[model samples]
Target chain A: MNATIKTLGLAAAVTLAAAPAMAQEKLKVGLLLTLSGPSAVLGQHARDGFQLAMKDLGGKLGGRDVEVIVVDDELKPDVAVTKVKGLIERDKVDFVVGPIFSNVAVATHKPIVDSKTFYISVNAGPSNLAGKSCNPYFFATSYQNDQNHEVLGKVAQDRGYKKVYLLAPNYQAGKDALAGFKRHYKGEIVEESYTPLNTLDFQSELAKIASMQPDAIFTFMPGGMGVNLVKQYRAAGLADRIPFLSAFTVDETNLPAQQDAAIGMLSGSNWAPNMDTPENKKFVAAFEAAYNTVPASYAMHSYDAALLIDAALKATGGMTDNKEALRAAIQKAEFKSLRGDFKFGANGFPIQDFYLVKAVKRPDGKLQTEIAEKVFDNYTDAYAKECAPTN
Target chain B: MTATLFFVQALNGLQFGLILFLIAAGLTLVFGVMDFINLAHGVQYMVGAYLVAAFSAWTGSFGWALLLALPSALVFGLLLEVLIFRHLYDRDHLDQVLATFGVILFLNQGVKFVWGAAPLSVSVPELLSGSVEIANGLLYPVYRLAIIAAGLLIAALLYVLVNHTRVGMLVRAGASNASMVSALGVNIQRLFMVVFGFGAMLAGFAGAMVAPILSVEPGMGDNILILAFVVIVIGGIGSIRGAFLAALLIGLVDTVGRSFAPNLLRLVLDPAAASQTGRAIAPMLIYIFMAAVLFFRPSGLFPVKR
Candidate 1:
């Protein structure tokens, strides 16, 4: 029995020694998203975009076999932390992505930073992390939370609106949005009302807005709340009388539900469906073919994140074990992004052009955003100045 | 202008209260009669909205969708009672809660699978598409007013069914003493099933009615479910009249508080502090009211003599 055991052990050692020479090392990517609750649609879009990018590369990153593990955070911060911990400890993922909401990002990113794993945020880019709290290993493929709203603020100011009523849900992101709007908007603020998140009815608030008689109404209600508010605003005969200006509220996800009510509504975003670019044209076509719906801004961000990772891997010649090479490659930002002129700013957030878009009826009678004008060129977040330069 | 704003807000409060009553009436009935704590009650409301949305698209008429969805919702509720809820009747409250909670998780995901995760919109029927002039220069959606009228009509119907009918007498007796009613040779299980099915249908009706005005998405019923519980507790569980008064009172307090709390607090506190506190306290007003009511009346405002 001793002779047989010695022979088996010798054989195992020989096979293990020869394994690395024959096959490349596997790259594990962990995706943490709010996949099962109220914000599930956002997560679904992110997942689809990531998968599409993988498919575009023929299911390999940097010529190395890849394994992706997706987890649902359920939109809870604590749940996000737990899932992220599991990703690092149990799954042993080298790279991490996702968490669509800012609050979830705040909770999940600290552990990733401590563990020294590469984190690419697909949706949320909170200001706290972009400024003094910035980490060397963190990058945001999406815009900083305030950048899109800043564009809307500038547009509203340029339109000569003297008095604007601001509305947002009561939360961290809501406060950030209002602050961003106030930065560039040089107008008299009529009223700033913070309604409870996920509120279905807005009649009372609409009544107040009507009484105040602001020149325009600016809001930041996202998801289903956005749909309800737009529908009710039109139903109340307020949409026509008062020009509506919003950010992240009248996007493709909720535009179908808003229908004619959304038409003529103005919003500012980094990427729209009708942007005239070859890369964007290819992305929108492939996404619609795969998902049978127009891809939203969240999906574009996730697609960009995957492409960014692929570019870094290729630049390093698939040497993921070399941390310095990988980080330098990502910072180079050489990938062709659907959003034109994409690059990483000092804060590791996107420096991309933002546009003023209006909801218009298409030839096919579908509601879609039509880019009216470029609002910002190679814009960086306010917190970029606070980030210390490492290079 | 202030007076006009006040009048409009009051009307909004009344409309919201009527919707709350519709949901709480059924919940209180099921809780009061069977002693079964079914946490999945909210999912029934969710199912109702999904069914209406699906049917409206297929049939291309809101009226047809309503006509078809109600019967389908009734059948669905009856099926649920027979398949899952019936086995849970004899179990303890904790077991019932666990089992029903499992149902909620299952059905919430089930709806998402059937109808994708995106929120669906049901267009208002052409007959009710226009706005009505409530006061001079004040236009309100006719659909919202229609919701109020329908809710009130259902409340009247429910009152008559519970107070002035044979089945209602059985329900009352069953609520008071289930074992004694069983001793009198009444099929108590059948009575329980009837109450459960009818209660579910009522909740479904409320969901279908609101689908056009509100976004019909998964988990939409969860928040309103808590508010309905507060309404039932404040009204005294098992009393339709209590549910009515408590629902309206809650609706008015919540609407008025949210609208004017900041202005009222500005009298004493700085504007910034007042607005912050007002937003923080608005969502809690119903719960505070519930605690106060329960403090004075432990059994609820109109607890039946069970």
Candidate 2:
């Protein structure tokens, strides 16, 4: 009996000691996202969506146990670089996924890609990354930065809007947004106002818009800025007079805060909560059940990123060491994306359909964006032409 | 058309300035009287916003929410004073800044823990829900106008209280010389508590009032706090009148500069280049104004008569 007790104690000790070793063998992933301030909701959704996918996969990726390290970028590019270096060197993650904002992505891109680890950008597909800077190791499950904005540009043209006022934060993504809109829009631009980021007050901008009396107002204010602009726009009674066409200005992420003010607001997007696809329906239901909030494109794209990784790993027979094989496997991964008929173009950015979505309060009282109509089919980014095919 | 646009922008500036004054008033008072750098004062404003948002959601009425939020904010301010800030009074300004900055980080996380990271909204009250024609063909939001009116009323009340009341006199004296006031046998501790709590309430009030218009989210107070500091610095460290005037000036400069900078720059540069440079430079105008003020008057426009 004494010998049996000793043997049992030894077994327990060995298991306890080997647990961390087991963890080391698990697939390591670094999740870097804007997890602070007003934009934190976007990151939270992304994180939750990724987590939900992991849970659904029985806590494994590519038939291997997985470990996720989440770090907040704090919406600071400098901070993101410092933290991402730590993720690469110290944690030594196999894959680095992240960054809801373009600036942070730009900041952390070179560091991660220069290293051996693969980068799967769940959000923030900066135009430059889609063009000449595209790398085989970097895959963007999300659509390119300008595609959604391009949807509204085309919509405005089709609707016969003669003049539109454009407003966006003065940044790379904002400039990209306006440029993308102008690509499809042949209308006269009454004015282009690029406010500083985190500009909550838009009364002056609205006043300018009112004076200009444009046929439509197009903007790209995301997160809290979106909530404020939508509310202020309604309160100023401009919503009744002028049509508001935007991308990321009135979406699921900020719609809860925007509520009635954002209702009827038209926005350009790749996918909505109401997109009718089996994969999307499953994603939305699972995401809603898990997080109790409607999953935005940020969440949807991140979820797709995980599936992409899994599919690639499966194709490689769970091998992560062979760089060329893994790269080709990821490129050719036949993962069913939440957004219908998704595929990567030459630039490693997704070739996907774009939609015109509207903010509406569902019968269940949740405010979410619903697909109003398809704007573009099998849309590939214009920047792809600038990129040499990795294959 | 330009004149009309200018007039409308000036009104927007006035409204924006008044809101800034509401926040800067308390901040100036606390800094002046206690000689304490409360970096957490901005978080206190954030708390007020959150409190009102929560209460408004519960009560289903804006009036009720504001009524409940004000006292809760006062109590929350007093609680922070009693708990954390009470010990830091004797510390050097650097220590106080570090300690209060820690408080800001803590409270920001705390609010997120309590109220999730998602932004919350408080609907505009029915009384101030729509826009009214403020000029021929120019419409201004009624809620914004109400904020201006409330700000003006509070400014008037503050001017009277600081100039006329006994507590106000004590506060001014404390700001000028705390040890001297203490030597005069007044309970300086109680006076500090009162000033600190009152200042917190004022900041809370500012946050609650703007909660209807702004998204109540974590770190919402951070940007405005920087603006408030600029207001106090330009207005003078401890002068209520100075803060008020400085707040208005900063607001007008910010609003008007943002509105007309591109047009002004268009005189010297192409339209695209002008708009780009103007947007880049507009946000810097307040800092420039502050630098000019400090250059001309090192102790601020109306320093305490020490």
Candidate 3:
């Protein structure tokens, strides 16, 4: 009898030893993105947007103190998995939201899914994950990678732009953007160009595209590269010679440097500063009032990401541990999106409006996204049809 | 392609090459002399551009902004050195890589935190604003040609300093053997600071010069950092002359290859295949060149003593 009691005691001790800390005083969150290098500008904006929402939440979420553990993936997939493991296993985060680059997300998705930790991506909706690879465990708070480009493609096609030259960085997101453009654009594509992922120089690509003498050039260079391309295009005197249609190319972040170059360029965007909505206006005013800066695209989506997470937690009645419940809550898209009427598709992407945004200098000497054009009032991504949710 | 179009494209290549050289000169120096790989070096360039934009606005003169931004860049470099880089001088390359990488994170965000993420423009001085008509029907922006001239002039100045000055002699000595330089009573530590500071300012100068043409924004330097790395690697980490040549080569290759790749492929394959292959190979061309150079000339085209 004494031995039996001792054995049971030993078993109990072993269980306690193996188990994770059960204090549960805080709900740890993991944020992974390219916090350094060229993409840092967007990453910084994202970080700000995420923190702004947390501040709005009075420094807590779901009645638990929030501890956000941010990691820099250095824009590498391997680094993403390593940092994510640290967050999930070591930090023991309750939920994970992050990884700006699509390739990084693709690399880290499997391990995260297997761990059963909810992944709410702030940006990058690679089509495969939105379709066949769709998992109940994953949700995207930002536009799917294809939606922006697809919208641009449709608009370009409608405009009867022939001999379009395609340009994007040589990376997974770039490839996806090209594929997305191809899905909607059926015009005679004169040529396609892929520059280095971190390349700032676009002169050669510019010259080559000019050589083709295309009616228009379509580009997907975001952040600084977008700015570089536009500025150089204007300097090269190609702006007047050709129509430069792009996806996520010129927005508030890039439009200022572009000046005259950005004036007539067309793009696809989910949120623009000029988007007229009470929610958008509130977001813009609050952001400008708070930071004294115009809101970039990153700020818009990342704010939505936080709100989406908050909505999921509230919908689940503040129960953070139930994965299925949280997934279902996110799928329902119960949050008040700054972008207006935001809902999640079966693929876990937004089923919201995709505006055909034009870059125009605001009367105040700063550039702004005016809704001079729009491709779809309510856009459904091309890959949504392919997502058989039930599997 | 028309001759005029090709000539314009070649000029574009030259302009791109010059910008690459400006960045690579500073980057390669740090790598070659200190054997330190700074990932945050790009942030230095970003700082340059921002300083130029803000100072130009504040001072209301491009000349003053240029003058003010140079010292600020040097001061910024010195601050970074004391704060983070000093500890990294003797650390392993991996740790140095990570820490400098951290500085990039802090500064990129810091810039956004202070200046915001929006792109800011530094207008080209009124003197150099318009375009210049070249050989045949090509009107090129005058600022671009000026950038090429500035880069070449800097290259010559760098060569003269390294090959013909007292500080240059000491720099060469330190790069060759820190132990010997120390034995010879040279202040190795101070020398390092000067090199680091000078390199930082040069990168900043590049940023300032380019800012008028390109938009100044956070994370502006990252792509140039990669190209600079490629130039240093291809040219030899410690050889400034090699950096000059390799910068031009990479700039021309990247620009020319990207332009001609599809057309070149069209000749060898069908139009569809050409476009696909060209798109696939264009970005890889420089990387392929780097790999080839590394394989053939392990230490680069010109390996410094260190």
lDDT of 3 by residue, A207-299 (tens): 566566888888898877788888878777788888877877787666656777788787888878877888788777787778766777788
TM per candidate, chain B: 0.97, 0.98, 0.96
Question: How many Å off is the CA of A386 in candidate 2?
Answer: 2.0
Task: Compose the digit string of candidate 1's lDDT tens values, residues B1-306.
Answer: 778888888888989999889888888888888888878888888888989999999999999999998888889989999999999989999999999989998998888998888899999899998997665556799998899899899999988999999999889888788889899999999998889888888889889999998999999889898889889889988878889999999989999889898888889999889988988988888888889989999878888896
TM-score against truth, every candidate:
0.94, 0.92, 0.77
Over A1-391, each residue of candidate 1 has an lDDT whose tens digit, in order, gives 3433454466557797755533454789998887887668889989988989889988888776889999998999998899899999999898898969988888887899888899999989998889888887899999889988998899989989999999999987888899999999999997789999899899999888888889999999999999999999999888988889898889888897888988999998998988889989999889989998778888889888888998898888776677877888998859988887899987778888999999988887878887989999988899988888762
Question: Tens digit of lDDT per residue, candidate 2, span A11-108?
Answer: 66779775445433678999999888768889998898899888877887887788899999999999999999999999999999998988898888
Candidate 3, residue A126: the lDDT equals: 81
Candidate that scores best on TM-score: 1
Better of 1 and 3 by lDDT: 1
Q: What DockQ, between 0 and 1, does each candidate earn?
A: 0.64, 0.65, 0.36
lDDT of 3 at B111: 85
**Model 2 shows how many backbone clashes?**
0
